[model samples]
Target: MKITTIETFVLGERQLLVRIGTDVGLAGWGDATLEHRPGTVAAAIREMSGHLIGTDPLPVTRHWQRLARGGFYRGGPVLGSAVAGLDIALWDLRGRFYGAPIHELLGGPCRDRVRLYTHALSARPEHTGEPDRARALVAAGYTLVKAAISGPVGFLDSPRQTARFVRDLEALREAVGDEADFGIDLHGRVSPHHARRLADAVAHTGPAFLEEPLRPEHSRLIGQLTATTSIPIATGERLYSREEFLPVLQAGIAIAQPDLAHAGGITEVFRIATLAESFDVQVAPHCPLGPVALAACVQVDLAVPNFYAQEHVIDLRSADSRDLRLLTGPEVLVPVAGHLDRPTGPGLGIEIDEDAVRAAHRDDLLVPRGTPRWSHPDGGFAEW
Candidate 1:
C-alpha cells in the first residue's frame, strides 16, 4: 500500500509525533521530538512529506536514502530527527505488514529481554537526595540508574564544586550499594579539565559510564578523557550520523549511545551498532523522549547482540505518568527487574492513544528558542 498522508501531531507538550497513514486502515507512528527545536523537526517533516505521500512504503531503505541524501543539504539535528521519526514509522509499517516485531524484521532477537536504566536529573551539587531517588528506582525493579550533575562547570572547577560532585557520587554509590549500577551524565556542561578531574574523582564509585562529559564538538577531547579515565565514555546522542561516530569508535571509546530519534532511526543506528561492535564497543540506545521513541529504541536494543542497557525517562515512580497515558489500550511495555520483555506484538508494539494525544495537543507555540545560553559566576558565557 502507498502512503496516503503524512501528518505530524504535537503530542503532549514537548513531543512531536509523525503519523504516516496508508490508504488501508493501518498507520504507523514515530516520534521526532527535538526537545528544544520540536518546531523545526515538524517543518522538516512537512517539507519531506512531499516525497513520501502517495509512495510505496515497502522499500524503506530506498525511502531512507531519498529522504536523507535526496536533499541538497543533509545531516543536521532538525533533518535527522525528522528523518528519524519517518524512518521508524516506515519500519513499523513493514513489521505490521508482516505481522512481526521490528526486531524480528532486523534479524530476530539477540536476547529475550532488554535491560533498562532510569535517568534522574538534578541541578544542585549538594543534593544528596539522589540516593533516595536511586533507592526508589531500585525498588521499582531497576538495577541501573543515571543521575545528572547539572552544575555550571567552568574551565576550572573549584575545590568546593569538586567536593560537591564527590558527595553526590558518594551518596549515589552508597545508596545503590552493590545492588545496582550507577551512571553520571555530565550533560556536556563541563569543561575538558573539569571532566577529567571529575571522572578521576569519581573513579572509586565505579560508575557504569560518564555520559557526554564534553560536547560532541569536543570529541577529540572525549577520546583524551576516555584515555585518562578508567570509566567508560558514552556519547553520540548529538552525533547525527555514522561518519561522525567513526572517530569516537576509533578513539577506543567504550560505549556508543546513539539516539534512535536523532541518529537516523533504526536503519542507521543498526549500522552504527555493527560498526561499534568491531571496536569492542557496546551499544546503548539513547532515548529520553516519549513512548514511541522508547519503543523504537527497545526494538534496536533486542536486535543487536552487543546492546547494553536502554535509557528510560518514564519513571513509574515519577509524579507524571505521561508515558503510560500517551499509549492506548493495556500497556504491554513495562520493565520488570530492570529488564523489558521482548515485545511480541507486531510493529513497534505500543499503540498510540490518538484521543488523549488530541486532547493534550496545541498549536505550535511559534516562539523562538534559539540555543541554550548560560553564564559563569565571573560573567563569561559557559557551555550548557
Candidate 2:
C-alpha cells in the first residue's frame, strides 16, 4: 500500500508525534524530540511528504535516501529529526505489515534484554550527594544511575567551585558505594580548563562515563580532554547526523550517545551504531524524551552488537504516571534491574493511545524557546 497522508500532534508541552496513514488502513506512529521546534519539524515533514505520498512503505532504505540525500542541503536537526519521525513510522508500518517486530526485521535480537541507566532529578551537586535518592533508586532495582554534577561552571571559576564539584562526586561515591554504577553529566557547562581539573578529580570515583564534558562544537578540545583523562568520554545528544559524529568518533572517544528521536530515528541510528561499532566504540543511545522515543531506542539496542546501556529519566518508575503509559497497548519498555527487555509485540511493539495522545495535546503546552542559560556567581554565561 502507498502512503496516503502524514499527520502530526504536538502534546504534553514538548512532545511531538507523527502518524503516517497508508491506503490499506494501516497507520504507524513515531516521535521526534523536537520539543519547542515541533512545528518546525512538522513543517519539514509536510514539505517532504510530497516525495513519500504515493510510495510503498516497505522500501525504508530507498525512502530514507530519497528524502535525505534527495535534497541538496541535507542532515541537520530539523531535517534529521523530521526524517527520524517518518523513518520510525515507516519501520513500524513495515513490521506491522509483516507481523514481526522491528528488531526481527533488522536481523533478529542478539539479547533478550537491554540494560538502562536512568537520570536522577537532583540538579545541584550537593543534592545529588544525599544517599536517600541513591538508596531509593537502588531499592527500586536500578543498578545504574546518572546525576548532573557541576551545574554551570564559568570559563574561569575559582578553586572553591572546583572543590565543591569534587566533594559532591565524592559524597555520591560514598553513598552509592561500589554496589551500583554512577555517571556524572557535565552538561557541556565546563570550560576546557575546568573540565581537565574536574575530570582529574573525579577519575578516582570510577564514573560509568563523563557526559558532554564540553559543548558539541569543541571537538578538538574534547579530544584533548579525552587524552588527559582515564574516564570515558560520552557525547552526541546535540549531534543530529552521521557526518556530525565522524570527528568525535575518529577522535577515539570511547562512547557515542546519539538520541533516537533527533539522530535520524531508527534508520540512521542503526547506521550510526554500526559505524560506531566499526570504530570499536560503544554506544549509549541518548533518550531523555518520551516513551515512544524510548521504545525506538530499545529496538536499536536489541540489534546492535556494540550496544551500551540506555539512558532514561528516573521519574518513569512510577507506573501510575502519565509518561509511564504514554503509549497504548503493551509496555514496550519494561525496566527491571536497570535494564529493559526487548518487546515481543508487532511493529514498534507498543501502541499509542490515540485518545490519550489527542487529549494530552494543548496549544499552551509548548517547548521553551531560545537557549536556556545558567550562570556562575561571577556573572559569566554558562551552559544549560
Candidate 3:
C-alpha cells in the first residue's frame, strides 16, 4: 500500500510520535523523540516525507536507504532520529500488513524472553537514596539496575568527589548484595584522566559495566580505559549508525547500547547488533523513550542472537504509569521477573491508544522536557 500521508505528534514530555497512513487504511506509529530536540526531529521527519508520500511502505530497507543515505548531508542525530521514526513506522506497517511481528520478519525469535534493565537513584551524585532505590528495584524483580554519576565533574576533581562517587556505587552494591547486577553510567561527563581514575576506584565494586566512561568524541581512547578495567564498557546512545559503531566495537567495548529511537530504528540497530556479534560484543539497545521505542527495541532484542539486556525507563512494576498510559496493551510489554516474553501481536506488538495519544497532545501535559543545564562553582558550563 502506498503511504498516503505522514504526520507527527509532539506529545507531552519531549516525545515526538510519527504516524504514517497507508492508502489501504492501515496506519503505523513510531517514536522519533530526540530528548531536547523533538521539534527539530519533527521538522526533519516532515522534510523527509517529501520522498515518502505516495510511495510503497513495504520495501522498508529500500526506503531507509533512500531517506537515510539520499540526503547529501546525512546521518547526525537529527536526520538519524527522523529516519529512525519513519523506518520504525514503516516496519510496523509492514509487520501488520504481513500479519506477523517485526522480529518474525527479521528471522523469528532467538530467545523466549528478553532481559531488561532499569535505572535506580537520581543522576545527581549527592542523592542519598541509591541504596533505597536499588533495593526497591530489586524488590520489583529487576536483577539489573543502572545509575548515573553525579551531574558534572572537572578535569581533575578533588579526591573527596571521587571518593563520594565510589561510595555511591558501593552503597548500591551493598543494598542488593549479590542478588542483582548494577552498572555505573558516567553519562559521558567525565574527562579521560578522571574517567580512568573513577574506573580504577570503582573496579573493586564489580559493576556490571561502565557506561560512556568518556564522551563519544573521546571514543578513540576507550580501548585504553577498557584494558585498564575488567568491567564491561558500554556506550553508543549518541551514536547513530553501524559505521559509527565499528570503531568503538574495535575499541573493546563489551556491550553496544544503540538507542533504537535515535540509531536508525530496527533496521540499523539489528545491523549494529550483527556487527557487534562479529566482535563477540553483546547488544543492549538503549531505550528510555516511550512504549513505541521500547517495543521496537524488544523486537530487535528477540531477533539478535548476541542480545544482552534492554535498557528502559518504563516502570514495569507499575500497573499504570506515564509510560503505560499511552498504550492500549501494556501487558504485551510488562516484564515478568525482569524479562519480557515474546509477543504474538502483529507489528510492534503493543497497540497505541490513539485517544490517549491525542489527549496527551491536546492537553499539553508532557511539559516539553529537555536536558537540564549545569555550571561549575566557578561559573563555567558543565555537562548535565
TM-score of 2: 0.94
Q: Considering lDDT, which of the candidate structures 1 and 2 is the better prediction for this target?
A: 1
**Tens digits of per-residue lDDT for model 3, 1-384:** 799999888875557899999989998989898887777888899899999999989999999999999989999889999999999999999999999999999999999998888888674546523788888778878899988887668888889888888888888889878978898888888988888888888888899999998888888889998888888999999999999999999989999999988999889999999999999999888888888899999999899999989998866665476568888768787778888889989999989988777766733433455678889989999987
Cα RMSD of all models vs. native, in order, equals: 2.0, 2.0, 1.8
My TM-score estimates for the predictions, one after another, are 0.95, 0.94, 0.96
TM-score, prediction 1: 0.95
Judging by TM-score, tell me the better candidate of 1 and 2.
Answer: 1
| Shift of residue 84 alpha carbon in model 3, Å | 0.3
Cα misplacement distance, residue 114 of candidate 2 (Å) = 1.1
For model 1, state the Cα shift of residue 237 in Å.
Answer: 0.7
lDDT of 2 by residue, 1-384 (tens): 999989888875457888888999998889875757877887888898988898889999989898778889988888888889999989989989999999999999989999887765564444444456776777777777788864556686677877777777777677677988788888877788888888897788888788888888786668888889999888898898888888888887888999878888898999888999988998899887888788888888999999878887625554566676666544456577666777888788888787877777765544446456676676866677
Error of 2 at 54 (Å): 1.6
List, residue by residue over 248-293, the lDDT tens digit for candidate 1. 9998788899988988888999999999999999999888887889
lDDT scores in order: 0.84, 0.80, 0.87
| Top of the candidates by lDDT | 3
The runs of at least 3 residues in candidate 1 whose Cα sits more than 4 Å from the true structure, single-residue gaps closed, are: 123-129, 317-320, 368-373
